[model samples]
Target: MDIAILVKLTSRAWSLNILASMNSGIPGRQAPLLAATSASRTAFAQSLDHLMQLGLLERNPGHGHPLRPEFRLTKTGAEIAQTATRIVQAVPDDTEFALLRRSWTAPILALTHRPQRFSALKSGLITISDRALSTSLQRLEDSAWIEREIDATLRHPFPTYRAVNQGFAVNQAIALVA
Candidate 1:
C-alpha cells in the first residue's frame, strides 16, 4: 500500500469509522452504516463516497438507491479494510496519531527523519503550499516530535529541523500501512 493512500484513509476523522461499519457486517446499507457510525449525514456520505472512489467499496447491483441501495467490499477493499482493522486496534480514540489525521503531517514527519532546511522539505514534498508546509512543521515542533537548529553554515543563518523522538508510533504506522 502506498503511504499516501494510507494517509488519506487515516486523515479524515470518520473515514475509519465508515470502513469499520462496512467491515462489521451490518446490513441495511447506508442507513445501518450511518447509525453504527453515528456520523452526521454529510460526513457519512462524504466518507462513503471517498471509500467507493478508493475502490474499497462497490455498489451492489442487486440493489439501488431510491428504494434501497447496497454496497460490498471489493477484494482490494476487503484487504485494506482488514489491514485497517488491525491498525485501528492499536489506536483507540487515535489521539496518539492526531497529527496524522492531517494530510501533510506524515509526509512531513517522514522527511524529517534527517535534518532538513525548510526549502529542502518544501522542494521534496512538491505540491505542498508554503503556508501548509510551514504550518505542519510548526505543529510538529509544538508536538515535540521535531525541533529546530540554527544552520550556522549559511551565509545568512537559517533554522533547520530534525525529528527528536521521530515518533516510533508513526514509524510503526508507516510500516503497518505498507
Candidate 2:
C-alpha cells in the first residue's frame, strides 16, 4: 500500500472497519456489514460507495437483491483488505481501533516509525491542518500508542514523536502492505 493509497483507504471513518469485517469472513451484504462495523446507515452507505469507486469493492452479480445488493472485494481490494485485517488485529482494544478510524491516524503512525518533530510530521502529511495534527498527536499520546519526548539536544528543545508498543505493530502492518 502506498502512503497515498493508505490515506485514501482510511479517509472515510468506516472504510477500514468495512474492509476488516469483509476480510474477517463477515458476509458481504450491506445489513451484515452495517452490523459488523456498527456504522450508521448513511456513513456505511457512503463508505461502501467510496470503496466501490476506489476499485476496492464491487457489486456481486447474479446474487443478492437489486434493492439490497451484495458486494465483494476486487483483487486489489482483497489485497488491501488483507493488509487492513493485519492492522485491525494489531489494535488491541476498541479505543485504539477507533483511533485507527480517524483520517490521519494510519499516516501519522506510519510517519512516526522514527522519532520526528511536529513540523516533520506536518510536512510529511502535507494537507493536515495544525489543529488536526495536534489533536491526533494528543490522542495517540493519551492512548500510549506513541511517546513524546523533548529533544533537548536541539537548540530549541522541541518535542519529538515516535511509535511505541501497539503503534509499532500498526506501523509494521502498514510496512507489510507497502
Candidate 3:
C-alpha cells in the first residue's frame, strides 16, 4: 500500500519471475532454478536472498555444507506465491511481451484453455461484463494468442474462441497458479 513498499517490490529484478518459475513447480535447487529462470547468477542470488528476508522462501542451511543448499517457499511465501502465481512467470509481467498483466487477461485465457463461445466465457467469468470480455478477447486476438472461429450453422453466425498453441504454455502456468 505504501509507495516505498511498492518501489521495493518492483525494484528487485527477476524476483517475480522466480516466484512464477517456482510456483509452476519447476525446481528447488539453485542450479535448476537458475536455468529455469534464465536469470544471471548475481541477480538471481540477490533476488533469492531478498525473498528469504521477506519471509517468502527458506533454505536448508543444515544440509549439504551450506554451499550447495536446497531452497523452498515458506508457508507465507507459498500463500503469496499461489495468489500471485499468474502474474509472476518465466516471462516477466511486462506490458511489452503479453497482455497477461491486464486485469482480466489471464483469467480470460484460463477460461479459454479450450474453445468456448462468447456467452460461455461471460457466464463462466460471472463478474465480467460483455464489453469487458469483448475488449479482453480483442486484445488476445490482436496478440494472436487466441483464434476466433465463426460458426454459421446457427441462425446468426457466432464466434467461438480458442487459444493458439503458443498461448498454452502461459495459460497452463496460470492454471497451476494455486
Q: Who wins the lDDT comparison? A: 2
**Judged by lDDT relative to the true structure, which candidate is superior, 1 or 3?**
1
- Per residue, candidate 1 scores C-alpha lDDT tens digits across 40-106 of 8887788888888888888888686855678888888877776655544544555655565566766
Consecutive 10-residue window with the lowest summed lDDT within model 3: 1-10
Local accuracy of candidate 2 as per-residue lDDT tens digits, 37-123? 888999999999999999999999998999999999999999999988889889858866888888998999998989999999998
Compared with the true structure, all predictions reach lDDT values of 0.70, 0.90, 0.69
lDDT of 1 at 96: 52
TM-score of each: 0.67, 0.93, 0.53
Better of 1 and 3 by TM-score: 1
RMSD from true fold, candidate 3 = 8.9
- Pairs that collide, model 1: none
Model 3: per-residue Cα lDDT over 10-42, one tens digit each = 346656667766788877688888997677999
Q: How many residue pairs clash in each candidate?
A: 0, 1, 0
Candidate 2 weakest ten by summed lDDT: 91-100
